[model samples]
Target: MKRWLPLSIIAATLAVAGCSKAPNGDTNTSTSSQVAKTTANEAYLALADDYFNHDLALNPISATYVGINDYNDQFGDQLTDKWLKQRHQLNKGFLAKAKKIDRSQLSQQLQLSYDMFVYNRNLDLVEETFPARMIPFNQFYSPLFSMAQLGSGGSFQPFETVEDYQNWLARLEGFISFLNRAEDRMREGIRSKVVLPRTLVERMIPQINAQLVQDPTESLFYAPIGQLPESFSDADKQRLTDAYQSFISEKLTPALLDLSVFLKDEYLPASRGSDGMWGLPNGKLWYQYLANRNTTTEMDVDDIHELGLSEVARILAEMDQVRQTVGFKGDMAAFFDYLSSDPQFFFDTPQQLIDGYMGLKDDINQVLPDYFDVMPKADYEVRAVEAFREKSAAGASYQSPAVDGSRPGIFYINTYNLRAQPKWGMTTLSLHEAAPGHHFQISIKQELTDIPQFQKFGGYTAFEEGWALYAEYLGVEMGLFEDPYQYFGKLSDEMLRAMRLVVDTGLHAKGWTREQAIQYMMDNSAMAETDITAEVERYMAIPGQALSYKVGQLKILELRAKAEQALGDKFDIKEFHSQVLLTGSLPMAVLEDKINYWIASKS
Candidate 1:
């Protein structure tokens, strides 16, 4: 899983200062036409820049993640009515201006930007109609979790200078404001009946309690103080340390405790008993909107449900083939049990797990060039997921490098439960979260000079996740999954995605309970009970997101198959990959159009 910030504007403004006027005060046809296109493109680019820059101001934490530090000390008040109105007006105004730009007169690239800008702004406008702001924070996606990661000092929040330290202190104050607002919003959710499941709210209690420490130095927020630069004067260091300790104990800790108490004493009792999105007001339409938004397609709920069922059946057969090859004599259920319990398949320690993923880096890097012509300049490294959030974190996930290359992409392997991180799953997991998967796709996009900041930094769930899932399948063709057990890992991971399609739709659309979704997963794959529960709750917390992996992978595969069949011997794997990646992330429809154009030109 790649950490995706919620803002979805992917546009760039190319400021072509001016178009040259015709000589002798007379217009030349070709020159005039060129000038018109340039003027139109620049005009649209300026509009895009306006939208992009304002969005960053509204999401300062996300701005920090993308390597922009202009608002590092601020956190936007996103759930307030004033904030919502400002956001709506921002989109509405930019969208109207964007539409006024004659897309036909812009160059092809700017036209793509124009279409995406309009689509995203329109989607934002539609999304605001739902009561999402009322239910702002959940166990899974929240500003709270982002702050925890940043405060740890190991993440993106810069602590390089005295100003950096002060920025974080100021940012902490803003974060506390967010917590207060979140409590207000969650209360609103309770009143409107747009609340989270009881199960998810239960998870939040422990998460919040973990932050309430009596000793400020023992807090995760105290990490930056310990890492103060050697260049700092003795007085400055002591002053900053005293300030941080006081802030943590006096301000931040109390805020966390208040939020935690609010959850236990009030919010939990009010949380919904029903697990799926259908339990909320107008939830059915909301889930459908999310389904379309996340997958970037107009796929109906029942169609997605059926597609999941079909994919599940198809992947199950492949798993059986792997089972037979491994000489397992028992039935699939027994095979799942044996695979789940076997000690040989599990990593002995967390360090070993980290080493196992790191070990694959060299082998994967060697084969990558055979399949991809373009590669990221910023490399990646494997690390254990921080203990604070590891319990709720995915089994493995990727964080893209900082835009300035100050940080390498991080492939976080959760070592909380070793059974969930099996030995056989290493290859497929590495391929998905690390090299030639997220790291490749995302880093390449950030490095792209031609696209706008939004396209470079923001992405659709389907396109980004879909590409990673497709990368896993690509590993098999690359001969990385040669061992039967490793091949089983591939099938296992694929089954997890295939099951997401069935389970996400089942939970949200069909009103499956949390237990039922867990059982569905347990019956289908050899995943640990811990992993199954976490994943199901993840879906409950953020409906329609789990559906992206398979929905996206299938589309990419379908496109590749079309390309392979059309071009035959003329097809080049490297070129096809470049075509998919070099444009940065795009909508499914736009991606297909681009591919079709490429195929036609090749033909």
Candidate 2:
């Protein structure tokens, strides 16, 4: 999975509370004539810069992640009405201005940029229509989980300096307010019948309880103090340590306990019994919007549900070929069971699991030259998922590198259950989550020059996840999946995505229970029951996100095939990839336009 900074971060806070400078306006041009004479490129680029800087101010956490330290000390309250109103107005105002820009006067590249900017702003505006704020967080997308990670000293939150440590203490104050407001929102959700499913709430209680420690040092929030810089004098270190310990015990612990107790005693009981979004108010329409938003297309739930079924069948047939090649006896189900049960496929230790993925970096990097010309300058490392949230997290996920290159991209492999981390799945998992996949695509986007910061950082889930899935398939052409088991692993990983298409829509639109979704995955693929359950619950938590993988992968595959046939001997595989990647993550329709234009110019 490619981890996305939640869009909710941008939808919060007071008006520009940070160290960001105002946009350098055209101070010399005092008249309307000068403004009117501004070129489309100049106007559009200015708007892009305005949007990026303004967004960074509101979304301080995201600012840190993107390598901007100006807002590191701030945490805007996302759950408040004031924040929601500002976020809506921000998108609305930008969309209006973006629409007025004359596309005809812009160069080809700016035209693409203009279209993407409008699409994103329009989508952001549409997202505000749904009452998502009423149901603030879940086990998978909780801010609490995110904050804990930031506090752990391993994530984007820097602990290298005294200012950095002080920044966190200030951020912690805002986090307490966020938790209080989240409780208020959940209470509102209960009244509105927009609460999370009971299972999701049940999972969340434990995660929240994990934070309610008797000793402040035992808390994840205390991690930064342990790694305080050696340069600090003993007196300064003591002061900082005392400050952190007090914050964790007096403020953070009580806030966590309140939320945890509320969930177990009040909220969990009120959570809905049904599994899908169909149970929420205006849920059908809301899910339809998400499907369209996540996939960056007009695909409705029915279109996606049917597409998933067809893809699942097609991939199963391919899996059968691998089953036969491996000389596995009996039916496909038997083969799935064999693969799931076999002890040889399991990793012995968590370090070995991390090492397995780490080991693939060299061979995978060696093959990159043949298929891709544009590669990320920033390197990546594989690490085990943190103990707090790994049980509920995806099998693996990729975090993009910091833009300043201070931090490398992280490929987090979940080793909570050894059985879930099968040896055969390592190659395909690595290909999808790390190299030539998210790490390559996202880093290259961030590194691109002459583009707006929004273009570098903001991306369509369909395009990003789709490209990663496509990269997994590219492993075959790169000769990385030559082993029959590894090939099965490829198919198995693909099957998980294919099933997600069916399951995400099924759970959200088609009234499927959680159990039904889990059973469907187990029937189709050799994934462990535990893994399948985690995936199914994940779909329930965030409807329509899972659909991005297949929807995006298929679109890219279609465009590639079209180019291959159109150019014939002229088609360069490397160039096809470069064209797709160099432009950053685009809407699928825009991507089609781009590829079609490339083919036309070549012809």
Candidate 3:
């Protein structure tokens, strides 16, 4: 759910030196070395701008959703083979263009830019073999659900102008084509034995069903019409209303029904019963590639699994201390059962679930400065996840602030199941999702002016997500997890992340069955049955992504420990944090190199 507008803003204004000839034909000569440096810098900057602008134009809806309102309502022909070819060619052209520039002539920021361009180009080399577009929709992330967000009146689609309303109508037409293409690709997947799990298909049924309401008034997609601009005359309104009805009845509804039937009747039956990617051709190699891309490391599955096991064992021992402090007359397993089944910790109502998180904002704000410095100037808010996508979305997720400062960073707490939002988990969740976690990391990164646009706005999952997971540990230092049960919640959360390293590799690399992975989680953590099922399914949908959190957290912690030891008395937590944040998110190896430079400089 990382938005692109902030990155666009950063990249948009990055000025590079290039001089055009005067209309008067006055040629002011400069030193050859100076001219060469300027040309090189300008060439690099132009390439960066080209990449950014091309990306923004191609994914205009993404641009709009991320608060880049210039291209307010648009979506590309994401389904066409020609579009894919163009996208690949675009990347290829940029890569070739970037390589011709001299890196040594540019500033440090530009050097990072050159390196990232090359790294991404290398990543593109592996993309063709993966066939990611083949298996697009799952229970977790899907373009269908994303379209609903934009079409829904409360989100990015501007309703104040008649043109805006018409813009969406055009966008929906484009989306219909994309969805059809998606279905075609998925059919290919069916033949290839690369389909999603049956469980995921079943989950998607409800999402499609929600769009099938016979009454246009009650449909979620009707919101735009309901809240259409007041500037529209009655004639215009009536015309729009008629057009929308026909579009829905004739186009949208049919598409939804077709997709739903396809999922239930065609795709589900062919889906591999097993959860792991290991069942596919070269699955182990595929997973290794994903791990490298996700964590930016060469650590193999066995290494990650072993690391997870060690971390899980260490966290469980800490949880045992919490049980002892509570004076519970039970074994660790029994205590875990007690925690899971107890209604005392559960919220009875959805508002209470939301209020519980809302309350934490004030409580944590008072203690935020205690841990480190560099807070985001943009305000933050908490809201429940929208009902349509909440069922499949992560328990809690963060959305960054708008680049123009019009929208605040949003911490969306899922209230789909009240039982899932336990009171004890709120503190750690808030810290991770709001303060010092995603909001702190992302917003501050966006605010940085010293770095290149790509570095400032770009992200590595391991660095960004790892830092968020690491933020949970910082709760202990902030004096937020003072209560033993709350402290145990932190350990339980850590254990879940550790479990991901094991289960993600288990599913993709080790050929572990879905049931087997779920059982492993049940045996290891205090997670509820509902939570465990959701987590496993998420890993199945997006392999190796979950691994980044734990891998990144450990790296950050290692570097922090190294900094504190190396600098000794001169070690400043604020300065250390500032250094980490100043670079935005980088690959772990790159992050290590950057931090090492900081450490050496202090000496």
Candidate 4:
């Protein structure tokens, strides 16, 4: 979960190899070629800059969340037709100009810029086909929930000045407008037969109902009013408080009521009964497109399914070895059940869960240098997932540092369910989400000097998440998986990712029910039923995203083996890792190409 901001342009001047002739007696031919090359570089860089700034302006909240404060905390008016047209036109114009740039003439970094821009444009095209706004209020990862976060105390919203409070007031009004537009777009989805799953709609009912409680003072959004800047005059404070109360009662409550009524009355009944994407029009084609887009490869659903099965078999055999070493008196299924039900492995309290991860930071730091040559200068911290969103969040996740260094990278452990946060799982989780995992890969990429901002900060999920998953494997080499139970935990975690490959495709491609997907997971792995249910629902909420981790990890491992075989004694693990991290995040295709080039250069 690295925070990716929109791409910015490079301002470097290029040096050309030759000169040109002048109109005068003095020959200037030698300088003319250099001037032309410099001009071309400048044009490309300028185009990138324009595209980046324009994108941030249109999606201000996304920019803010990623720590791009150019818009200074303003939110977008997503409801207005004028805003929608402006956003579409911005993408179109950038794509048109980007197409004109001769990619072959640019450096490798510039070429990546061209490719990412094209990929983003392609996404824009497909995005129009799906009516995502129709089912916006999921239990996890909703824009509405994010809005409450930004406006609440103890978060990013600044309340130091009167102007700061006023800024939020303006933003709140825009949020109301955005919700209205979301309702309109969902209505369109209802008509188009692209509604959300009924199960997801049912889950959302409690969330919407919770917001409708009659006391504005007790509402989460009221925190801003309660904590208004101390510098404000008493008169101003009273006026602001009264205004917010009125706004919440009159405008915000009605908006929430309208949205809830629509979801319950108009949208839920029309929601799709089937869980898979294959139920939609052109579903097979749609899923194929998603598979390629997410995996960053042309491999079809069948290929991915087979790959997952093979990996699952291999990891299961490894898990069995751990069972025997511990002298467990049962088969693999019994071992899994023992692992799931064992009380000694579970955390009793959430703080104990948080402390376990906090202690690992130093332990990992001491051991990381043995396996990785490149390390991030950016620091990291461990924290519990925010209470509001933790129930639906992944078991553990990472948020990358701000490009400007204002914020540290965060490893958020979900402490919502202490039973789910096993002590044995902590080491592998730490390795994947923190040191030498996401925090290492993402922060170092952002710190690179020679690449364009987009390549530095932009992320392909397969590359980012896959690299993190692969990082867990590296822990064994670093001697972190010493305990047999911890080793079992590593394999268990890998199995979960491998299962994602099977179950995600099963849900979105093979038309698996939510229960069917959950059952597949329970039958295969040691995860709790509660965890399996959460994961399956997450896939339903955001299709094609879960498939990236295992897919990307396999590709990286494949490349490493190839490099090791080719270079023989010349293969330096540190150097191989340096090459990968130095290039920043790339599509799997581009990553493979870069690795191939590195291999050739070594030869």
Taken over the whole model, the C-alpha lDDT of each candidate is 0.88, 0.88, 0.81, 0.79
lDDT of 4 by residue, 1-603 (tens): 222221332223222232334567344554654455455555676776676667778877767655665554477866466876787787777888888877765655566666777877777766656545455557667776788877875455566777767777777787888778888878887888877789888877767777775888877778888887778899989988987788888888888898889889988898899887877766667777777777888888878888888888999889988999999999988988888888999988888888888888889899877677888889998989877677677888887776667668889998888878788888899989998889999999888865555566578889988999999999999898999999988998999999988888898888789989998898888888888899999888777788899999989999999999999999999998997888788888778888888899898
Candidate with best TM-score: 1
lDDT of 3 at 570: 85
Q: Is candidate 1 or candidate 3 better by lDDT?
A: 1
Q: Per-residue lDDT for 372-475 in model 1, tens only?
A: 99999999989888888888988988999988988899999999999888898999999999889999999999998766678888899999999999999999
- TM-score between model 3 and native: 0.92
- Could you give the C-alpha RMSD of every candidate to the true structure, in order shown? 4.6, 7.8, 5.3, 4.1
Instruction: Write one digit per residue (lDDT tens) for candidate 2, span 1-603.
Output: 122322322221111222223245533333332233234656787888888888887789988888888888888878788888889889999989988988875556768888999988888988988989988889889898889888888788988899999999999999999889989998998898999999999999888888889999998889998898899989989999999999999999998998999999999899998899999989999999999999999987898999999989999999999999989888999998888888899988999888778889988998899887889999999989999888789889998887889889999999999988888898899998899999999999999875677889899999999999999999999999889999999999999999999999999999999999999998899998999998999899988899999999999999999999999999999999999999799999999999999999999
Candidate 1 regions with alpha-carbon error over 4 angstroms: 1-27
Q: After superposition, how far is residue 508 of candidate 2 from its true place, in Å?
A: 0.9
True-vs-predicted CA distance for residue 242, candidate 3, Å: 2.9
* TM-scores for candidates 1 onward, in order: 0.95, 0.93, 0.92, 0.91
User: What's the lDDT for candidate 2?
Assistant: 0.88
Estimate, for each residue in 326-350, the C-alpha lDDT of model 3 and write its tens digit: 9999999899888887999899988
Q: Is candidate 2 or candidate 4 better by TM-score?
A: 2
